[model samples]
Target chain A: MTAVMETAGLGKQYGKRWALHDCSLAIPEGKVVGLVGPNGAGKTTLLQLAAGLLTPTAGTIEVLGGHPGSGPEQLGRVGFVAQDTPAYSRMSVSQHLRMGALLNSHWDDELAFRRIEALDIDPRQRAGSLSGGQRAQLALTLAIAKRPEVLLLDEPVASLDPLARREFLQVLMEVVAEHGVSVVLSSHLVADLERVCDYLVVLVASHIQVADDVAELLATHHRISGPRRDSRSLPADQHVIEESHTDRQTTLLIRTEQPILDPAWTTRPVTLEDIVLAYMGQARDQERARKSGLGVLR
Target chain B: MMRFAWLQFRNQAAVVFGGLAVVAVILAITGPHLVHLYDTTVATCAAHGNCSTATSVFLKNDHTLQILFDALVVVVPGIIGVFWGAPLVARELESGTFRLVWTQSVTRTRWIVLKLGVVGLASIVAAGLLGLMVTWWSSPMDRANASMYTAFDQRDLVPLGYAAFAFVLGVLCGVLIRRTLPAMGTTLVAFVATRLLVNHFVLPKLIAPTQRSFALNGVTVQGFGQMNGGPFTLFPANPNIPNAWFYSTQFVDRAGHPLSTQVLTSACPLLESGPGPSAPAGGGVESAVPAPGAGSALHDCIAKLAATYHEVVAFQPASRYWSFQWCELAIYLGVAVVLAGTCIWWVRRRLS
Candidate 1:
């Protein structure tokens, strides 16, 4: 199957500064892709570009085989939940669904109505009157009602409480399972993405730090703790990313293909959270180095 | 789109109906009563030879109404522009509802075009209906007293055209400015400026008299009572001149020079002024001057002489009522189209 979404050297510039830069990514069809980055990591910009809310200043972006800004048909295929959970305050929950029906060719009113009713949201309650969680749920309902081929959600559960977040992700997972629609969700919460996403893309300091299958990535990435040594001493296949050393010991987050053979080193499998933090640390260091023109990476 | 616009209209029906009903009631009650009272007074004066007093008071009332009509048109449309049109786009922008509409299967251009078209039609209809009603209500008075028909003077067509102009300008400002209060302010400023432009500059040029007539015949002319005469201005069909057909003097033969004066009179002295003997040959300069009031002895002699070789030359030009209407309408319509076009262009190019 064709890649449902693809970006090649896609960068967005706000004046002289880059919001997202040098991003190249491709996610194949039928996979739940998670975009993990810290705040202002250009995650939202990337998602907005993919969703056609913004134009990329450099390079190319495609959503579901067509260009990102292909307009209504491409837009109809892609459903975006912006960070604000934007909705018409005057419209009722049912009216929002009605608006979705009017705007989308493949509107699934039954699914929307069912989800709203199950959530116990009164059809007549105005969107402005809804609680934060309820409004998030309503926004999700509107996004899902379109039955879009590619759903691009930017931090859908960012503001929700733990319970609401879990429930929200659970419903998303259920919907994707039933429809097999490709979803690209951006979030800083790696644990949630680990539970629900099949694929992962880590963006750090305006660059793609990593992109791989979540399960595969977790399997290969290992944290090796040992006595201090120069990174040049490691084998060529081992990519040591975030290295911290005490006088006695060195703990390195490394991506390696082979199991550790050193007797002095203790190696353990890394969690998704651990991998994400490693990337985050690398991003901060890179940003600091770029700002100050210091060579911290050898 | 029409359905949606109608929905908007229905939602604000209370405001629309309430305002219209109140104004209508005031017009219905006060308009006819004032008109009738003026008519009765005119009739009473006509029977009692006290036409001057009744004419003055009734004409003043009519003038007041003329100014009121102009003011009324501006205020109503300004209200609609500020309240309805400013919020038309601002409310959506403020609530972020336009994103929902904009991101849909429909094109943004189509969405805006539909909305503007519907609202524009509604605005025009409302203005047209109101204009028709006012025109009907004031018809009897307009006929009875032509001077009271100050529609041309006050730029009445501008207000009708301005309602739409104001509405469109408000919506455009709303979308471009993206803030409700600022948009309302801009709309008010724009409407007021255009109205003032029409009233002060364009209307005057359109209706201002260009040629003045220089004679008054078969009438009791009054109130140029203190003309030692250098250059006196005359109003054609002067209200102060009763049954007096008035005209203006382009030039007069005075002091052996063709000096110019717009002064209306019973006569002009028919000879040259020179340093000659008291009865200089062929200098037939009269020592006599006409009495000031109507039906005086000297006034009769001058009227007879003026009748013999009557030549009424214009000192100022003449202008028509509809000329003012058309010119003012053209100006206002031009503004409307430019504004509407700007609105369309901005929405298409910069709206997002």
Candidate 2:
């Protein structure tokens, strides 16, 4: 399958700090790709790089086999909903739709009106008066009505209440199912992505910890608990992502292709959140080690 | 893209144009009466030999309106820059709506170009209409004052160019600053600074001034004086050219060298007097009239001075008013175009 978005060693820096660094990923077409990370983990930076809101400081990025925001055709093919879902505050809902129609070559007027009507948002109401959920939905309608091949959303539901978040996800899933457009949305909450995302990319500390099909990741990663032991003794094939030990018990989140043959350990299936958190913890430890190692060198 | 630009610009345009319309109606109502007053008084005052009184009366007819209109022409372009141009791009960036519009089926270059073109054109048109209306309504007063250069900045063609330059400068500031209020403030300061710089420094050198020499006769010599026992000096009256921009008037010898005090004292012993009656304490001319009984001595001294030295005056003639206006317009428009190109480049390459 063709990759909807691809980056090779992509990096972005602001002044002395690197927002995203040494990132490489090829997101397959037609998948709900969840870019999950902790706060300040460069999730927004990577998404913005793909959406052409920002340029990479190192390496290169391509969306749908074209440079992001390179030309009219490239711009038309990709849709971007920024973090705040900003719309012209003074402009009414209908004016926002008019703007979409006027600015996009392939604007789906019927779809735009249908979404607004179904959402029960008043066409004459200004965007600034709308609730947070309504604003996000309006922003989504604008993005999707342009009929883009790929949609990139940066923390669209980060500010919404749980119910609003659920409704947003439901609408998003319906749009994805109906249009089959590739989606890449960033969120700090893994639960937000759990219901809709089929592809997962775990980013931590300005780097990609893991990226893979959700089912494959679940199949390969297992949480095993047993009597206290050193993680260094684990077989090389079973990579320990995260490890915890008490006086008499040890638990490890491991990624391995083979089943655990040791009967001493109790192995249980892991949720998506478990997999993400394990990767996050592993990345954090590595970062801490690198920092303290530099301190020693200094 | 044009439609979208207009859609965004229409409200600001409405407010500005509506204000202009109200001003236009007021001018239309009072304009003909002012013109009629000028025709009856100042125009025919020459035959009655009461031109001074008639001209003053005509100028004083709409004193408050004159100040208001003149101030309007000067301030409108800066207003356009601050309210229209600065916020045009900065608001989008500040509100994060650029992400929505820029990602549509339009290149950033096209987006900026269209926005600038649409709004810039409207600003220019507004300034032009304002210039035309004010120039028409204020014609009587301008003629009565007979000092065209005094009101140069608040008059025709130049304001249009100023509006263009101010608009583009604001856009450049907005693009670089990326915030609305700060950009507006910066644009205002920048626009005012540029106008002051151009007005004070750039304008005088635009065209070489015309030089004319007048013999140092009694009529040409406004006054003469010696200050605190210093060398004697002569003051030449302004050249008799109406509505001219005078650069300077110098007392020069036949060889084009400045006439020295040593030569003056030697040629006329009467100059040894403390100061001429017309000379103020600091050597300025208080009156053209010579002291009582010293008139003949003054004439003799002037005659002696005229034989060797003459008064050289440099000024821009009234006939060159249109030329200066056009030159200023071209300069402002040229700079505006360069600034606009810079804005486009910055938006495309540097903004992200």
Candidate 3:
């Protein structure tokens, strides 16, 4: 019952800048994890580190109980769909399948062929000529054929149209149901994460703002409104992830393990999108404070 | 892995066939014609009153044409190397197809190693086959000519070695540059420049003397005076002239080889039984016929000249052909290994 992927204080750096900073999370087996973030939130960097495509700059990452890049065997167990669905343009659908068969120890050629056929891609048509959706589908087909224990998808459906996007997510769910493979998909679209993911981790400004089971998160996090007051007065366990004030009224999205017992404040459930927007605003406010050399948001 | 390599080879068959055909045709057609011309002209000129003029001109032209053709071998393979090697990985990276292969269970190291192994071996084979054709076609011309130190002969190990070097260099450049046009350009410039430098400078010093010296008119003799000097000069100006000479330095022996300056001088004393018996009486005239001290000069001269002689100076020795072939192959293959190792390191640590 080892965690499928575990990162201990992980950080990724390119030159002087950090792509992902102090990210510590454990994604257990058999769960679909959604890595949610705004632009440049280090989502792709985190996925790449988990998939062993990149080495962590500051800390360790383990995949299936060992170092991320242990060897081909570990790589075979962890399939990755890199951002933008980078398919070989000159190769035909059949060629990709051949490459999969050659490179993977657990290749499911029959499944790949069937999937490509179902997608209406001509086996002979070059990937270069395929539509964006078709290319993304083809890339997914290759990843699924490997039958990996863990799948790391970085913006897998970012390029597809709305209709294609829905179909791609549906296909992923069907595969997950049949194979029980652990998945970690990074995306900017909250709606996509909302429909398919059961586990969620929100990243903003290179920080992990929230990590929890989606059901538990939806069940507990609430928006509370009451008379204006300093945020420091809130209970220590009631963490306010984002707060806004307007002339004697204070609105806050607080993550709490216990039920709300106070009668003075009004509490309402918040959607994932609202939660993401709140985190983004908090990040922007912190950036402004740091630039002005003032501890305004303490 | 072999299948992938074969696929690459099949795709590039057109270039391989085209290059080989051009090399063959040029060698066959021009080779025999040059041989016939050399035989007829040198004999006619030797019979006529100017053997020196006939031989010198023939050798010069022979040297020029041979060097030019040998250079073609490098050019043809070079074109193939630049185009083939530069595009091998760049095309994959540029088109985003590399991710498909990279994500598979096979490590990046295996992918690059297999590609380089198969293609590199193919290059050596192609170069070896072309070398054989060139050797066969030019046998007659090589036998008749004597520009041992000229570019043609000096260029013997060149075509094969440079082709392999250029191909591997192209692969490395492609990986490092990660773009087609610039990789091809850099590889071509680097390969050609390195080759020219090696042939013209480093290699000559490795096995052959750099500045070869020989007296023109046999200066300083034992018994004979200047009149008996009989003026001797190098027929082809050593054939292996310095690469930078504007014209052959004709060492004008205007002083009719004086006896003290030329009568069996130490410059090129006749190979004989101990220093011409201290110059015989009666003008000390040594007959051209082979006698003890009489024959000793020519015999010893021939013996001394034997070591510098070559059976086939224009091409490498048959015995050492495979040795040179394998050595060049190893150099490029070794380079391919190093490049692949770098690629693995990048994939493992920095690829994202």
Candidate 4:
């Protein structure tokens, strides 16, 4: 299958600081990809780069086999919902729908009106007065009704309440089920991604830590705990991701294709959150090591 | 795209055009009455030999409306720059809605072009209509006033170009600044400054002024006074040039050299040399009353001065009014086109 997005050495800078730097990824088609990172980890920057809302300072990015936002054709294939779900405050909901239809050649007017009607949002109400969930829904309606091949959302549910976030995810899942559009959505909350993401990309400190199919990531990564020991003693095939030791016990998160043959450790399946946090912690440690001019500990 | 542009612009258009409609109505009703008054009074005042009185009375007929229309014409372009142009792109950037609109099937180039084109054209049209109405309505008063260059900035064709330039300038500021309020402020200041600079510095220099010499015949001599016992000075009245932009008037000899105080003191020795009783103290020049029997002597002195010297007046004649209007319009429109090109280029390449 063709990749929905491909990047090589992608970097973006603002003044002296890099918002996203030296990043690379090949997100495949048709999966709900989760871009998980901490706040200010350049998730929004990466999404904007893909949506063609920003220009990379260092390298190239392509969406759907073409330069992102290169022309009307390329722009028509991808939908973007920026963070905060901005809408014209004074414009009515119906007017926003009209704008979407007017600007998009392949707009699905029926689907848009259907979604708006099913959501119980008043078509005449100004966008500024809508609740956060409704606004997100409206923005989602606009993006989806464009009939794009891919959708890029930057933290769409980051500001919504728990119930609103759930509802938003539900609507998104329905749209994905109905249209089968490839989606890449960023979020800081692991639980939110855990529910909807089939593929995972963990980002931290302006860099990508790991990106892979969720099932493959889960199958390769394992949490093992045993008697206290140095991490250097682990088998060569097992790549240690994170390690913590107490006085009498050692806990390690490892990624390897091989099974544990010695049976001296208790192995358990890790949740998506566990894998995300382990990667995030490992990246943070590497950054700290680089900053302090010290070698990686163990 | 055009429809979308119109949709976005219609509300603001309605507000401005609605106000214009009201103005048009008032001008339509009062315009004919004004023309009638001018025809009955000022137009025939030449035969009655009371033209000054007739013109003043006709000009006073709708003094408030005259001021209102002139002020409106002057201010509307700036208002369009601030309220219409500044917010065109800046508001979208400020509110993060550019992401929504630009990502649609439209290229950013097309989007910005349509937005600027639609609104910019509307600004020009609105200003043109305002200029046309005001020019037509004030024709009577303008004819009576007999000076086309007095309120030059607020008159025909120039306001249209000003509106175009101001609107584009505001768009450029908005694109570069990426914020609404600051762009609006900058547009207003820049628009006003450009208009003033062009009016005071650039417009007059566009064409070299015409210089004419007027023989000093039967004209009043303003005063004769010695300054700090240095030289006796003559202050001659300015030459009359109707409906012309007078730049300067100076007393010059036949060779165009300026007359010296020594020549004036020697040639008109009948005039007092020191600060006479009629002259104000501190060596200032006041209208010196002639000594009771010195009228013939004064006339002879003026004739002698006229034989050697004449008044040179620098001015722009009334016939050049339309040419100046066209020149100014072309200049502003040209700058506006350059600014518009810069805006498009910036929006395409630099903005993000």
TM score of chain A per candidate = 0.95, 0.98, 0.94, 0.97
Evaluated at residue B2, the lDDT of candidate 1 is 45
Tens-place lDDT digits, model 4, residues A79-139 = 9998999999999999999999999989999999999999999999999999999999999
**Per-residue alpha-carbon lDDT of candidate 2 for residues B1-352, written as tens digits (9 for 90 to 100):** 9998999889999999999999999999999999999898999998999899888877888899989999999999999999988998899999989888888889999999999999999999999899889999998888888889998988888999999999999998899999999999999999999999998899999899999998888667866764455566776788678899999988998889998878877887775563344453343334334577556666778887787899999999999999999999999999999999999999888877
Kindly indicate the candidate among 3 and 4 with the higher DockQ: 4
TM-score of each: 0.79, 0.95, 0.77, 0.95
Instruction: Please name the candidate that would achieve the greatest lDDT relative to the true structure.
Output: 2
Ranking by lDDT: 2, 4, 1, 3
lDDT of 4: 0.90
lDDT of 3 at B337: 60
For candidate 3, give the lDDT of residue A119. 86
Proportion of native contacts present in model 4: 0.88
* TM-score attained by model 2: 0.95
Candidate 3 residues B1-352, lDDT tens each? 5675565467586678677788778777777776677678775765778866766666665566566656655575677579777777777677666665666787666777777777766775677567667666555455444433333422445455555666677777777787888989998998778766855665433333222333432221222222255444222222333222122222232342222324334544553224333333455244322335644454454344334431111223234434544554455456546755665555444455
State interface RMSD in Å for all models.
Answer: 2.7, 0.9, 2.0, 0.8
The DockQ-derived docking category for candidate 4 is high
Model 2 scores a C-alpha lDDT of 0.91
Worst 10 residues of 1 chain A by lDDT: A289-298
Q: What is the DockQ of candidate 3?
A: 0.45
Query: Proportion of native contacts found in each model?
Result: 0.35, 0.88, 0.58, 0.88
In model 4, the Cα lDDT at residue A253 comes to 96
